[model samples]
Structure formats: C-alpha cells, structure tokens
Target: MASLSFFIPALGKEPESIEDKIQLAEELKATDFNRFNELLKQVEDSSVNLTAEQHEQFRFLDAYRLAYSGSQTQAVANLTELVKVAKSEKVQFKSLSVLLNILIISRDYSEVFQYLEQYDQMQKNITDKDLRQHALGILALVFNQTSQFDIGYFYANKLSSDAVDGKYACFGMQFKLESLHRLKKYDEFDQEFDAGVATCEAAKQPIYSKIIQSYRVERLLEVDPNQAISLLNSLYQDVEQTSYNVLITLYKTLYSIAYLRNEQLDVAKEYGLSATKNIKEDDINYAILLLYSTLYEIEKANGNFEKALTYHEVLVSKQKAYDDEKAAGLLAYNIAKANVEVKNQRIALLDKDNELLSLQKDLYEKEARQNRLLVLILGAILLLATVLAYRGLTGRSRFKKIAEYDQLTGISNRYHFNNQAKIALDYCETNAKPVALILFDLDYFKDINDTHGHAVGDWALRAVVKTCRNFMRNNDVFGRIGGEEFAVVLPGCQTDKAVLLAEICRDAIAGIDTTESGKHFSLSASFGVSGSDNSGYQLKQLLADADSAMYSAKAAGRNQVATFSE
Candidate 1:
C-alpha cells in the first residue's frame, strides 16, 4: 500500500508522501544521529489530519528509523516506551520486532525468551496475515539465534509461506537459513541460502543480500576455502553496503582468518588490510576486535615481527577500551532498571499514605460532628467534656474484619492471603523446604447461586472454607481469592502431598449439606495443585500453575484433584 500524501507550504508547497518520508528516513538511518528528526519536526509543524491507520504507519516508521540508526541500548529504551503507544497490532508487531532484534543484537537471549510470550499474546489478536508473519518472523529469528532449530524452522518456514508476503519476507527466509546452518543440515542450508540470496537481491535489499552471503560463506570455509573466498570476493567487489560496514568488515576479517589458516600469508594480509580499512570508530566492539586480531595473526604468519607486535599492542589496547565501555554500559542499564523499580515503589507507598490520610480525615470529621451534636444538646463547654471513646474506637475497628477475612466465609481474604502467601513462600524457599499452592473453585457455583439463592451460595462457600481449614496445617496459609474461589498454600508439602490434601478436601466438601432444614443438597468443588521445583519458587508462579490445574480438573470433572501437567 502507498503512504498518505500531504503538502508542506513552507517548503515551496512541495508534496510529501510516505515514500518520500521513508526514503529520507533511510538516508538518516545510515548515520549515528536520531533518524528522521528533521522529518519529525516537519510533521509536527504540519496540521494535517491523519487517519488511525496513517498515524500508526508513522509510528512504525519512527521506531524503524530509531532501531536502524540508534545503538542497541537506545533502540531498546525507545522501543520499550513506544510499545505502549502502538495500540494497533500491526504497529505493535513492527515495534516489538525491532525491539526483539535489538535484544538479539545485544545478545540478551533471556529477555528475548521473556518477550516471546508477549509477542504471542499480541499475535493472537492480530488477524492480518502479513502482521502475523511479521510477528512469527521475529519469533523465528529469536529461536534460530537461541539454537532451537526445530522450532525456528517451523515458524520461519510458516512465515515464508506465500499466504503472507511483504517487506519482512526476507526475515523468514533469513531465519530458515540460519537455523538450518546451526542444525548442520548443510544441503538444506545451501538451498535456502541460494533461494534467499535471489529473493533479497531481486528485492534490492543489499544488506539482506550481504547477510545471506556472510552466513553461507561461513559454512563454505569449512568445506571449500576456495569457493568461500570466491563468494567473499564478490561481496567486496559489489560492496555498496556502506550502511552495513559492519558486515563488510566481518566478511573481510573472516576471509583473512580463513586464508591465514590455509597458509596463504600474502593473500591473507591483503584481505586483512581491506578489513581494517572497513572498520569505523563507532563499529561494534566485538567486530572491531576480531578484525584487529585477524590482521594481527596474518601479519604474524607473514613473519613481519615488528608489524605483528604493533598490531598485538593495538589489539590489547582496544580490548581494554571495549571492556571498560561494556562495564559502564551494563552499570547504566542496571541503574536505569533500579530507578524504575524505585519509582514504582514510591508510587505504591504514596497510594498507601493517601489511603491512611483519607482514613484519618474521615475519623476527624466524624469526631467534629459528634462534638457539634453534643454541643447542641449541652452547650459548648459540656460538649468538649463529653467524650464517646467507645464509639470512636468502634468506628476504627469496623473495617478490621474486611481487611483480614472474607465477609461471607469468615476466612482470609485475597489481600491477606496474597500477603501471607509471599511470606510463607519466602520462608520455605530460604529454608530449602517444599511448598505447594492449591487453588480451587466450587463447580457450578453460579448455578447454585441462581437456582437456590445467594444465601445458600454464601453458606456453601463458608462450609467449603470450614472443611478446608480442618484439613489445613496450622502453618498453612488459607484464604478466599474471591467468590467461589479459594487458595491454600502449604509449606513443607510436595506435589504428591498437596494433591493428596486436595483429594481429601474435595471429598470433605462432597459431604457438605449446602441447604438448611429439609432442603438438603451436597456440594462439590474442583481443586488444582502446584508445587515449587525450587528453580521456580514464587507465590505468583505457584498461583498461576495451580489456577491452570484447577481449570483442567473442572474440564475433566468436578470433585476431583489435578496437578499441573508438564
């Protein structure tokens, strides 16, 4: 689809379109500056009304420019903030793709894995075929880099399917080639590499073409150095990828390394020199280090002792500089993360302080009213003397039960349960003890509430809580998460023991007579159990596992206990 068009009256009333903006973005993206700042200023100055889709397109464009031009740290920072504003799924997918790629380039695999879930959730809502491919293409790249070859191949190949085609088509093909290479499927790699090369070249994506060449040449170096050299030579011959100087340097460095190993000292030195010439001051530290070391080794092989020594000293200096820079960057990232955490903590504290202040204000106002009533009855002097201490004390205690317990069941409420659950989990975790979390809900609870009455429903909930308390250990944390839902956290209990307890509780509830007098009826509930593996020990984790298990139990049949499946 073509981009929306507008006119800028100040610039000779020149016409501007999305293509014009994108072309400008590409030019600026090659530099270290914030891409499209000029265009951003121009757009802000223009009072053009953009449709929702047009607006979203510009958002995607801005993030792309940032991701392309900025450093990994800057890209991650900007994209993280952009995701919240990218309400459209297409825009969101594009922004997240850029973000995940930044993480990949930074080698933050754990964060990539963490974000896969977010991507999956977002993709589930996106029905646009191209957007789906865009999302899957990012996931495929992540899996490929993480060495999950089978999974990577599935998504990449799926994304490459012709049902979805666009600018991101190369991404799917790129991941397919990479994952196959890592899996050591050489024949498949060769085929995909050739196919990807054609597609990227035909599409005029020189950077993508260079990337394909880079990957293919790596495998060729192992099997046939001559063929690898031929391919690498072609890349340098046609190397208009000044925007991708990193790849050119990397390819050149690898070429030098390969020939140096093959005892072609003179040829290796030539390639090494070319590689060094490609290095930029702002290039990636690892690539710069590799190029220096590759050149250093080639010179050493050629028996130029003085030249080799000079290169060695340079390499050492660069390494230290890189290390220092890395340490500083990591410290900054950590400090930023800590600041966000502290900010959230302050907001929570302020909310709690505000609630307390509101409570105190209410109490003061009530006291003043009481004093005024007393004055109306027995003059101002006597009003001050008349103190109703009991009434004052009673008002404060009225909400005490609400804070600690479920009103209907007289058991712990969600707030108290969660608070105490965390404490119990922490203690068990520290002591190397087992802990199990069991979440359960009354089956057909609404049916009972509808057919019988809310009063009967309330009685049934109380009865269930009473029976659960009977089975619960004194140290166990038990509470109602909400209506018809309750949790029992057992410290020092393993999966089997927790499931056993759930079974016992289930049976006990089955025997509960939910009706009063002659209207007797039995009640049943489904239970879900989860135990910590020690690797993952947290209340929220356990609660989620147990909640999932309970739904499984409900699906199977009520009055049964289920533990989370692998």
Candidate 2:
C-alpha cells in the first residue's frame, strides 16, 4: 500500500550513511518526488563513493522515479536488467516488485502473474521483517484486484496479524475489507468497515480511508439510497483532495447512481456528466460502462427514452470492446506463457544431451570401444523416442481441435457447445445479467441434400455459418448442435434484442448467394428466440423452449422468427 514497499526500507531523515541515504530515498520515492530527486543527486555526487550494491540501489530508486514520472519504458528496461544482474538480493527483489508494479499499471496482468510466481519463490530467501509484511500486503492487494478473493483474504489476514508497523497494519486491513466486500461477506464486511477505516485513519492515510468508505457506499446503494447518498457526499471532499482519477470517477459515478435512485434527476445528470469526464486513460472501458449505465438509468427515469436508448447502445458498444480487449489480453498472456515453457523445454533437452555426452566421454576414457558403440546406439534410440514423443504431442493437439469444433463449419460442435454455453450462462447468472439463446436451422436442408449432393448442402451450412458469424459479438457463443440446427447464446441480451438479431439472421440467410456453392437455389432459416427473462438461466430449459418456438414458427410458416411465449 505504500507503493511497492516490499523491498523498500522505512522512511528516515538526515542521512549520515550510504545505507541511510538509500533508506531515505525509498521513503521519499513514492510520496515526495522532488525530495527523491534531490536524494538521487546526493547519491550520484562525485565526492561520494558507493559500493556495487549501493549503486544497484540507486539505480532501483532512479527507475522508481522514472516509472512514476511518466517514463515507464526506460524504467521497465532498466528494472528488467537489474532484476537479472543485481548483486544484492534486496536490489533484485526491489527490481522484481517495481517491474510488477509497472506491469500492473499497464494492465498486463499475465506478465504480472508470471513475475508473481518468481516473487513467491524469492520470498523464502527474504528475511527482512518489514519486507515480509509488505510482501503479504502486496499479495493481498494484487489478488483482490484480480478477483481472487479467497487467496487475497488469506494473505490479508496474515499481513494484518503479523504486521509490526501501523501503516502496514492499515494496508492489510484495507485490502482485507476489499476482499470481504467482493467476496460478498456482507455481515463480515459491515462489521469490519469501521475498524478498517479507523486503522487507516490512525495511520494518517485518508486515501485508504476513502477507498474503504467507497466500498460501504457501493453496498449501501443496494439497500438504502439515502444512506448511500450521505456517504458519497462525505466521500467527495477526500476523493477530490487526493486528486486520484480512479477514486474521483468512482465517487462521482456512485453519487450519480445514488441521486438517480433518490429522484434527484438534475443532480444525478450533473454528476453523471462530470464522472464521464474524469475517467482514467489507462482503464477507460470499465469506467465508461459504469458512467454510461448510470446515465442511461437517469435518462430513463426522466422519461427521455430516446436519450436512454442512445446511452444503452453506447453501453453495449463499450461492453463489446471491453470483452474483446479482455480476450486479447488473455491471448497475449497465454502466448507469453507458452513461449516460456518452450524455452524451458529446450533447456531441458540440452541438459539431457550434455548428460549423454558425458556418458560417451566416460566410455571413451575407459577405452571400451564396444561400450562406446553401445552408448552411440543408446543415443540413437533416445533420439528416436524423442521424435515419437513429439509426434504424439502434436497428434493429441490436432485431435483436441477436431473434438471441439464442427469439421464442416469450424464452429463449436455439440459437446463443446454445451460446455461453453453452460460456462457463459453460469457467469451471467452469477452477475444477475440476462442471456438469450437463438436456435435455428436451414428450412429445407434435407431437401437440399436430396436435390443436390451432400457437397452443396455442406457448402450451404458453411455459408450460413459465415453469414451468422458477422452478427455475433466476441462473447457470443455460436455452435453446430445437430445435423442442420445451430445455436447462438448471447450474454446480457434481453428478449427484444435477441428477437431482433434472430430476424436479421433469418433475412441474411434468405439473402445468401447460392452462387458460391455453384447452385442457383434459394436459402432460408427458421429462428426461435428465448431469453433468461422468460426461461431463466438454465441452458436445458432455454434450448427446450427455443425448440418449441422453432416448431411453432415452422407450423405457422417456414423462414420466420418466433419468440418463446406462454
């Protein structure tokens, strides 16, 4: 909570020694930028002679300054090298912590977790009392941010119970309350809130105090509007004084939501507008969604349905973009991890080669020509085994891909579809979000297969898939569920939007160009839509209801969209 203090010494003034200067710099690094610069100058003075470890410490401090001062590129480049080559364990630990800090700021969570593993391993060798407390505090905060609340709660307790410093204790309590809030330990959170805020106040950290209060405000929004408004109003001055963009935005958003619920339309509109203007640059997606969502509610309450619809559309667009960005981050993280595994495997193979070479050398020194031949034969056999193992690995990977996707259309097959749909539905249910399912199939697929050949029918299916894919969001689940039937699961979609999307797909199907399949026949699909609002979040029930609706559409006429009704 003191900003990457796992390897930083406690603050002290008037340094009389190099160690004292380093300690003082660590103290001022996060709080007082100008003083940190002056301390850097004194450390870099020509008359002062510094040891190798001390020099590394100075570099660490310099990188910290660069990172906080908008020169993160150079800071990361320097810290990365220092993490590898620093002679002192303290400096190396500090480098790793700062590197993690930079990664977190950049929202490169994958690398943060990767480096977190390294930090976890290094913690065993670290013996400093303050450093251990800081490490626990950092772990608690990071885990909480990443939504690993149970682990965060565990570490927060450790940090708080073991902390000797009041500041560290306050930090531990702050994050512990955060974990409880996210974990939905409501009764516990209510019990802990006052103590957490009091501890932060005792430590003279109004910022942490404000953060704890914001959590209370968020909880109160669901239960007591007036109390939530009162808390938000009290929180406004502290948040403004801190000038922290994230807190400022959160405070305003909560204030607006509170006022909207309390029937103060003008005040809600004012704060909603102000909140949007204060969104942080690094993390705009989630903030924008929150701001727009509150504004949408406010507009709807004011009976300005058109403005509300516009805000709702903006909310949808922002959510899609956020989902895409999250997917890309996961992809990048997986790629990075895979690269590391490949490098480690290569090193392992080289080690085995070295071991084999040593055996061959031993045989040669013994002057056993026959044994040398035997060793060479064994080496060949080992190489053959390695090749076979590699083939087996690749073969399994190929089979896995085949098992998960429809061979003809390259979308999820029935089994994988069911699994993925369930996961999506579960997530939506957890968040109390709506979901909609669209079940459709070609109107006359059997007729098409009989009139033409299976080749043309297959081409038609693939074409339908391609057309439908265009209308789906990144988070939407599309799959081939049967011979001619397909399903699309749209999270956060209500029935009207689902029906609209189904109608669009139906039209698109009717308009598909048969020329691509080298045929001149028409195409059509019957669509059935069912949403959680009517059918609940169970996939089985949704699919069953959509199926009934599809048959109803077919009985009425072919190539029509039908919504599930009582």
Leading candidate by lDDT: 2
Query: Candidate 2, which ten residues in sequence have the lowest lDDT sum?
Result: 1-10
Determine which window of 10 residues in candidate 1 has minimal summed lDDT: 1-10
Best by TM-score: 2
In angstroms, the error of model 2 at 319 is: 3.2
- Write down the lDDT of every candidate, Cα atoms only: 0.71, 0.83
User: How much is the lDDT of residue 508 in candidate 1?
Assistant: 77
Q: Can you write out model 1's per-residue Cα lDDT over 158-238, one digit (the tens) per residue?
A: 776743343456666777776787788888887677778777676566766777677777777778888888887778766
Candidate 2: misplaced stretches above 4 Å?
Answer: 1-20, 45-49, 280-288, 321-566
Report the lDDT tens digits of candidate 2 across residue range 478-520.
Answer: 9999999999999998898788778768878999989888878
> Which segments of model 1 are wrong by more than 4 Å?
1-82, 85-88, 98-114, 143-151, 162-167, 231-235, 240-243, 285-290, 303-566
